[model samples]
Structure formats: C-alpha cells, structure tokens
Target: IRLRPGYFPFVEPGFELDIHCLICGGKGCSVCKYSGWVELLPCGLVHPNVLRYGNIDPDKWSGFAFGLGLNRLVMMRYGINDIRHFLSGDVRFLYQF
Candidate 1:
C-alpha cells in the first residue's frame, strides 16, 4: 500500500491508498487500466474542526479515516472480469461467493 495526496473537507491531511494491481501482476491489464496500480481507498487524518463538531476535543483527540472500494476489492479477490456480475441478480454469480 502507498499514500498519495488527497482532499477531503472533514480531514486535515488526506490521502489515497493505492496498491499494485494484483490482477495484472504489475503489468498493464484491463483490471489495472494499464496503470499497474489500483486505487483501493481514500484516507486521512481527522481534522480538528471535525473533531469539535463531533463533540470531541481537538486538543487531545485524534483520528483517521479510510474508505474502501468494495467493487474493486471483489474483482481482485475473485478475478471477476465484469463488474456488472455483482449487480446482475443472477444466482450463478451470487452463489459463487
């Protein structure tokens, strides 16, 4: 995993997490879109202002956040070629999991 700069109103310092494309094995592939890396999540340290708004004291409290891309994760895990397989409501696809 690696961190890249990002922007989020609720966070002081934000980042995006990227992992080498598992499907491509670091090579260009449809799953990787030829980038050789996959963006799996956005994350960040909690902003002081956001802490205060949540009734927490910024002076002592701190936090971090991460957002996962579920669809991407699934594709990597199962080597799924088409994302629509997840939403197709087909028993054959759903039953695989």
Candidate 2:
C-alpha cells in the first residue's frame, strides 16, 4: 500500500491512509483485538514542507508498511472460548484440534 502525507489542522503532517493487515484478510480477528490488524501506526511519506518543518529533508526519504494479527484469528477459528485457554495448554481442547 501507498500513502501520501497532507496537512491537517490538528496534526503537522496528517496521514490520509494506511496499509491493511494481512491477517484475517482485513476481515478482523480476536488477536488483532477485533481490529483485524496487529500494527496501529499511521504511515505515509512525510510532506516535503513538513519534512523541512521538522528540520528533515523530504527529498531523501520514503517508507513502506504492512501488518498482521495471528493470535486473534487462531482464537476465532478454533472456538477457543477464551483467549487464556490457549496458553493453558489444556489437553481436552488440544485433542479437539
């Protein structure tokens, strides 16, 4: 995914977009805290002026991003009942899978 930086009244360099999480195929998951994503950082190329505004050169910088949520999906798929159960290593549940 690609994102562009723009000015927002509240933020110095506002990010208008972010990448989708690979896990759950962006559908959402328990591991992602039901957010369907693991990473929650806003990503984008810093605006040239914004770069200068922060005393950094925009001409020399670029960025890329991706995210995942493995555990949440595992809980959702296996009918784990509770997230803590997975950690307990319960024999009954392990046998079912």
Candidate 3:
C-alpha cells in the first residue's frame, strides 16, 4: 500500500514497500498470483557511515531491490496441471500458456 526508503545490512541502501495491482483492485488475480498484489521494490538511502565504512561516498551512491514470484503467477494464469510442470521442462504444457 505504501513504499518507504530505508537501509539494511545486506544492502548498501534498502527500501520497504507494498503495491496493489490496478487490474485486480487489490483482489486476488491471475496477474498477481492470487496474492492480490505485486512487489515494486525495496530501496533505501545509503548510510553516510556505511558508505564511508566501505570507502564509498554516500552522496554519489544509491540502490534498490525487489523480488518476483514468476512461477506462482504462471500457474494462476494458465490453470496449470501442476506446479511441477514449470520446472519439469515440459514443452506441451508450456505452449498452452
């Protein structure tokens, strides 16, 4: 529903956020993998001390992050016979979608 810039240890800069799909109106949808939403990205500001600790300038650096659930969405879209098919390398099933 909202996105905010922040920081994380693993990433120089991090962001936390939530998104609603216009197509689904926040309801479950094939496009959203029945989760009713999609991830935009996780991005944030680089800590001045963190950049300096890494020997990089805080002023010149920035970053962002996000994740996708590709397989889940595919299943929802096609009504696949099984989730295993996605990784099973079956051409027949893949073509239908």
- Name model 3 segments beyond 4 Å from true: 4-7, 10-14, 22-24, 29-35, 57-97
lDDT of 1 by residue, 31-88 (tens): 8888888889988989999899899998998999888989988898899867788889
**Per-prediction TM-score to the true structure, in the order listed:** 0.72, 0.31, 0.38
By TM-score, who's the top model here?
A: 1
Clashing pairs in 3: 14-43, 14-44, 15-42, 15-43, 42-65
lDDT against the true structure, per candidate, is 0.86, 0.52, 0.61
Across 1-97, the per-residue lDDT of candidate 3 in tens digits comes to 7766655665655666657754566787655567766555555554577667888876887544355445545554555434578788879976876
* Candidate 2 per-residue lDDT over residues 1-97, each given as its tens digit: 4455645443444554434445455676564456544433444444466556767665786433322334435654664535577778889867877
lDDT of 1: 0.86
TM-score of structure candidate 1:
0.72
Number of the candidate with higher lDDT, 1 or 2:
1
Question: Which candidate achieves the best lDDT against the true structure?
Answer: 1
Decreasing TM-score order of the candidates: 1, 3, 2
